[model samples]
Structure formats: C-alpha cells, structure tokens
Target: MFAKVIVDISHESIDKCFTYRVPTDFSLSVGDPVLIPFGRGKKKGYVIGIEELADFPEEKIKDILSPLEKEFSVEKQLLDLAIWMAEEYGTTLNQCLKTVLPVKKKTKNRTKPGKIQYGNPYPAPKLNAEQEEVLFAMQEYFQEEKVPSALLFGVTGSGKTELYLRLIEDCLSKGKEVIYLIPEISLSHQSRMRVEGRFPGQVAV
Candidate 1:
C-alpha cells in the first residue's frame, strides 16, 4: 500500500504530499504521525491518505520508519481544517498544522475563580432608524442556516459601538461566542472595558 504523507517541513516548496510504501505487517491510518526519510535526514509526517498504487518508482519509494504516539495523533477534522487553511491562505500545509498543533503556554498566575456569564444576555440599546435597519439586516444573516459575515462601516461617533454591543448581546442570547476586533491600540482598552463591564466574566482581552 502507498501512503500519502505530508512531511512536517515548514517550507512552501515541499508542502505537497509524497508517497511512501507501507510495510506489509505495518498498519497506518489517516492523521497518524509517522517518521519518514527526507533527503539524508528523517522527519515526522502526517498520513493524509492511503492508496494501492505507487506514484513514484517502486525502487525509489521509501517505507515509513515508524508511527509516532498513536494516542497523540492529530485528529482528522483538524487535519482537514489545516488543509483548507493552507489552500485558502496560500501557505504551507505544515504552517497551518503548526497553528493546529500550537504549543501550550504555561500560565504564570492561576486564574481567579469567577462565575461564567456566557449565556447571560445584555440589555439592548435604543437605535435610530438607520442603525436599526443595518442591525436588522445583519441579524437576518445570523438567522440563516449559513451565516455570511458582514463588514460594518461608519464614521466616528456614528453609533457603531452600540450596534456591536447589540449584536454581541444577540449572539450571547443564542449561546454563541463573539470576537470583537479593534483596529487601534488606543481604542482597545476603552472597548475592552466596555465589553467587560457589559459581559462581566465572559470578556477576554
């Protein structure tokens, strides 16, 4: 059997898959981590596919060295998402996988115990006619099976923040997570404070 492996090399040139021979007695599956020969050195790779035919010359095809920890293998759903990210962003698959398998950072301080305010809904703000129209249009996007994203554009002091808070409250009511992005660092602190005050323990800077 031939195994299509995506080697864990963070280079765009070698991001594509290479076929390797699977030993007769050896077992392999998608998302399994394996050691493979690349150049003179060996590197870890993810098994993305398996096939019966050998694309490369039979003599040139190499066998997988061994499987990495079976328990720690990457999940298939995550592997598919990584593949999608690589294609969509024009980046190496290994680079996407790096994000998928990011290193866990140790927290310097223990988190303070607090009540989760996730499902709690915030009070709705009164909106002008223009703001109400835009908000209702955006809300319809969320009501559909496939919610398409929207970009909100308004001049300064045009009640954009209020609209954002109202949408956040709507999402919170539906048990959905919200990500609010502030373009400027100067605005981040103020917006974060407002969100924290409104959402309490649920807000994360």
Candidate 2:
C-alpha cells in the first residue's frame, strides 16, 4: 500500500505533498497524523490520502516512522472545515491545519508519567420548571433535520452551565462529540475545570 502524506513543512516551495510506502502489516486511515522521514530528519504529517499504487518508483518512497499515538485523528469533517477556513480567512492550509492539530510536547524523562488528575463527577441538581421547559424547547429544535446554529443568552448567575452540561450529556449518550469554545481567556481555566469535574475522563483538556 502507499500513503500520500501532507508534510508539515511550511516552506512555500515544499508545500506540496509527497508519497510514501506503507508496510503490509501496518494499518492506517485517512487523517491519521504520522511521522515521516523527510531528508535527514523526521517530520510530522497527515495521511490526507492513501493509495495502492505510487506515481514514483517504489524504492524511492520512504516508510512512515509511526502514527502519533497520543494525538487524535483528524476527522474528515474537520479537514473540510479547515479548507473552508483557509478560503474564508485567506490563510494558508498549513496555518489552518496547525490550529486544529495538537502540538507535540517534549517530556523530560522516560519515567512513567503520573496519571491525569480527575475530579469527581459534578452532582447535577434536578432541573426546575423553567429550566425543564427551556431544555425541552432546545431539544426539539435540535431534533429537526436542518437545525440552525443556536444562540443562548442569559444574565450572569443564570443556570447556563447546567443547561450546557445537560446538553453535553445528551450528546455524549448518542455517541457525539462536543466543542465548547469560550471567548474570554480568564474563564477558560475555570470552565475547563468545571467541565472536567462534571465529565471526568470524557473531556480532552
């Protein structure tokens, strides 16, 4: 098998992709982030595509070093979203990809790392009448085939976070992932901790 890798090099001249050989025993998927031998060093890249045949000679192609075991695979929807972002924002594809992909972190030692600290699950209180009505209305809106983006507005101290947690739980129950974005840096840490305590292992941050 052959894999067409989009190397992470930022040079305009080297922006185009290259093909690499895939070992027979190796299993790979599109959007899997991998390390590939590029010149004298290894560079991270993504398997944008895969093929059984290579345009170049078989001997010229290098094998992938390995997949980034700790990194999440890029979803096809995310790739499409990246392309759309590049065109919409007038940015390079690499820039867009970099924003969505995880950065490699260096560990100082080879010793086994400590496990992530997980907080106990948040104890959710029973919803009051108003909250229940709002939840049901939002759920009904989402049940439609062509649901539009939603905007929820409430004053400070409103049970917005509770509502969000409820919706997140519902989505998780259906095997769906959620992306929660916060505009303020000050709130990022607090929100992450709260969500972490609520969802525990289910959160990535």
Candidate 3:
C-alpha cells in the first residue's frame, strides 16, 4: 500500500503531501505519526490517506522509514476537519493544521466580510428548470464539503452565463467572495465587459 503524508514543514514552496511506499511489515493508519526521508534527513509527518497505487511512477516514490512514537499521533476528528479545509480552500494540510488549532489571542474579529452585488445597469435573466437544477446540485454539494463545485457541460449559448450569474447572486446572498478566472489576457477585456455589464461598478477586471 502507499501512504499520503503531510510533512511538518512551514515553507510554502513545499506545502503539500508526499507519497511514500509503506514497508511490507509496517502497520500504519490515517493520523498515525510516521518518519519519512525528506531530502538528506528524516522528518516526522502525519499520515492523511492511503491507497493501493502511487500517484506517479512507483520507482520514484520514497519509502516511509518507520512509524513514530504515539505521542506524535494526531486525533482522527481534527485530521478529518483539516483534510476537508485543505480541499476547500486550496491550501496544504500543514497550513490547515495550524489553522485548526485554537488561537490564544483574546480578541476575535467580529467584522463581517464584504461581498459584491449586482448593479442596476443590467436586468437579470430568468433561467429554465434545467438551469435551476444545475444550480441546485452544486448547492447540495456544499452541505457535505464546505466548497461547492459543479461541472456545467453544454453547447454554446445554452444559458451557461446565466447560470454563472445566478451562482454569483447566491454567493453574494451568503456574503461570500468569488474568484472568476479567465485564461487568456486578450479575452480579459471581453470577459470583463460581460461581467461588468451585470455588476457595473462592483467589479474589477
């Protein structure tokens, strides 16, 4: 079996899990502390997952040297929450570990996050039942995973843009921010015009 381990490193450059081949006689489980060879020396890491196959070539993956002491083991509940946040926020497990820990700072931020809203420059489009169904599926995913994701597959001019606008409306209702990415710089102007037409002064390229 192969294991996915999040090494105890603070550097953002190497902020990801490293897959290691489990020893034949080793006993390991998720959340167990393990010692793995990192660079020229060994580092302690927490096992987050295990699978039957390696993510890449089998020969390149390193072997987990040995299991660490029990004192270094992590709680399963905390580990699960950390894994979920890592997937949702595009973050590494090591960073999430620090995030999940209780902050000793006496004052907490009570201020709410700002959200962009639709401007009056353009009227919103009405979506058909099929389009609404796609939105519903994505919102359903949010309950299980904090991040909601859905694949919108259809031919051109199928009201896909309308669906995106609806999603932006939903996000704004919940006071959440959205990052809309465009591939080519040349298309950026056209994309911005479409979005700003609806959002007006609420958008920045």
lDDT of 1 by residue, 1-205 (tens): 9999998889878989999999997888898889999899999998999999997688989999888874346678778888998999899998887766634444343334663233234455679999999999888877888866678899989999988898898999998776576888898656765787678767644
lDDT of 2 by residue, 10-32 (tens): 66566567899887777899888
Residue 130 of model 3 has an lDDT of: 86
Predicted structure with the largest TM-score when compared to the true one: 2
Ranking by TM-score: 2, 1, 3
TM-score of each: 0.60, 0.72, 0.45
Position 77, candidate 2: lDDT: 77
Question: What number of clashing residue pairs does each candidate have, in the order they appear?
Answer: 0, 0, 0
- How high is the CA lDDT of each candidate model? 0.80, 0.79, 0.76
Candidate 1 worst ten-residue window by lDDT: 115-124
Q: Model 1: how far is 185 from its true place, Å?
A: 11
Per-residue lDDT tens digits for candidate 3, residues 103-158, read 33443334345423233255677778888898788666664745645677889888
Sort the candidates on lDDT, descending order.
Answer: 1, 2, 3
Best by lDDT: 1
